[model samples]
Target: AAEHLAATRAGRRAPHRVAVAGSTYSVFPVRAGARTPQAVGVSREVRETVLSDWLLVVEADAGDWAEERLDLLYGVTQLIAVERDRRDAARTVRRRLAQEVLELVQTGAAPAEIAARLRVAAPVLLPGLGAAPHWQVVVARVEWEDGTAETGPVAQSLLEEILVDPHATGPEHSDRIAVAHTGDEAVALVPLPAVSTEHDGSETGVLADALLESVREPLSAGLDGDGRVTLGVSAAVHSAEGLRGA
Candidate 1:
């Protein structure tokens, strides 16, 4: 596998046939580890401008490996690449929105301008939630003992994962969280329905406490001794100025 990966990195586009244990296998390079290959498959180079240092490889059963199978693997790999690109684009847009909002809040931009930006951002972050819903801010920081891990992206991803309500119904419910990274801290903007009977304006602490309840044990296990995760949840804010204060 290492040799085939090297060959692909060195500009070898053709598939390689190799023996593993007692059987013959075909190998292909994949763009990233995220692209899960079948039991038997081919690998393709992941490229943007210059080729990435990694390849996507798929492996298949030796007896079933044929020209048609090869074509099928290639097609599947292409589809995965397309999906990867789409995800990257969506992530870029979300990150930009988060960053912009963070900057505006930090710089004390006009309430009208900040409100306009939030209006634009509402659909992407909160999706099906209607206009001007109450919002909560959750700040998370992950600290590693050796400072080796990249905490910003990791915290952003983890914050999104943690903010999702596993029992919630509807597609848009899971998409109601948006997180931005500033230095080592991840800031999450969460939207709540304007009219939840469970809590009122001054009771955002209830919501905040609930956010960490289910995720705390699992996340603590993952952090273990190597790192620590701390979170500060703010009260619900109704307007752009309120968001800045939160």
Candidate 2:
């Protein structure tokens, strides 16, 4: 997989094929009749504040953008940029709120104070929820076998991506999550809906297996051979009092 993006001269170039993760190297393969296909396109990088190595590849049928409907491509790129801006803003809020909540938790603040903070953070984190959801803690540590001072920030970014709710409706597009980093660790306060009466609580909330299911390979490749990430999920807790023990 090619992960690094590079500046390209103005126009389209055709490359056979390659693989990538959360890829932006856009390839628009066009075929005429039953012909196999002509592969070529332009690569434009979209600047996402959290993870910016995304490339947009556009392969065309005519070997160039002029009659290949370049206007439509520009529109698509603009749409993507706008959506990235929206998501990035939401993530910034989540990180800031997580930092505050983690500070209170670590300092052993009163449960009442913690609960109050959670209350204020709830609406922002879980917009459109009719009521506040139960909460859980997800703790992750990212470290290099060789070691580096950048571990904490890296962990924070990784956790944010992992915790996003792919099915989430509306603009936030994330689980009711607040993630903060301290030292080599990132802690996420994940908001969950209440368990139903007949169902076992065990069936609800995040599971370590499920959280890592899709991301395991990508995160591994990102570690550069000498780094690793470890994650743990806490049982759901109802209020601030349970946050510490969780």
Candidate 3:
């Protein structure tokens, strides 16, 4: 699989045969894995210039994937690419909204104006949300060992992945967090369910410690020699004015 991916052009989506030691997978893409040569499968790559790209490999229990089946697989890839584009477009809007909101908070905009903006943004940022949620802000920083890498988008992506609700699936997680990045820092505005009927904006202590402990080892392994991720979580706040303290 590594060899096949390495051999393929990252910028192209054309179907190509995946050749193995003694045989070829053809455009049907059934030969790269350990499965028997007769196992039915299809492979396709979805290329995205604006967002992350992915390869799709579909396997069947038995039989061969006839050449005629390639058309169906190709259609499936098209649908997937369409969905990817939709999600990417939505992410761009979410980021822009996040930037505007963050700027309002930092600049001390009128509370009524910010509240109105938040109200307008609620449906887009948290789809199908029942009631308002208390908001928490987490800021992340990525520091490279040699200090040459562009860390803003990297940290932004990392925080998006890290903050996703673990119980949800796929793009559903994308709508739940608004992240904006500048320079080497990414600020994530996360919404948590209101814990009680009444709430005071008190400091939530040690969020960073608990989060750091859970993520450090696995993150360290993935980083290997790249860099480190640092995170700090603020006290949950309920109103637009409260966002300043958050």
What are the Cα lDDT values of the candidates? 0.63, 0.62, 0.60
Where is model 1 more than 4 Å wrong at Cα?
A: 1-89, 127-130, 196-206
lDDT of 1: 0.63
Question: Please, what are the lDDT tens digits per residue for candidate 2 over residues 213-244?
Answer: 86665555455465567988999888888999
Ranking by TM-score: 2, 1, 3
How do the residues 46-148 of candidate 3 rate in per-residue lDDT, one tens digit apiece? 1101111234554431125564565566555556657756766778877887788888887889988888777767777666667876678899888777787
Residue 116 of model 2: what lDDT? 87
Which candidate do you rate higher for TM-score, 1 or 2?
Answer: 2
TM-scores, one per candidate: 0.60, 0.66, 0.58
lDDT of residue 230 for candidate 3: 76
TM-score of 3: 0.58
Error of 2 at 55 (Å): 5.5
Compose the digit string of candidate 1's lDDT tens values, residues 1-246: 444534443454445556667766666543333233342233421121111122345444534567676666666656766765665456667677778889899898999998898888888866665556777888888777778666776677667656665566656443566678987788887776666654543224226567677666545544545567788888788999899889
Number of clashing pairs per prediction, in order:
18, 6, 0
Off by over 4 Å in 2: 1-16, 19-82, 128-131, 167-171, 195-203
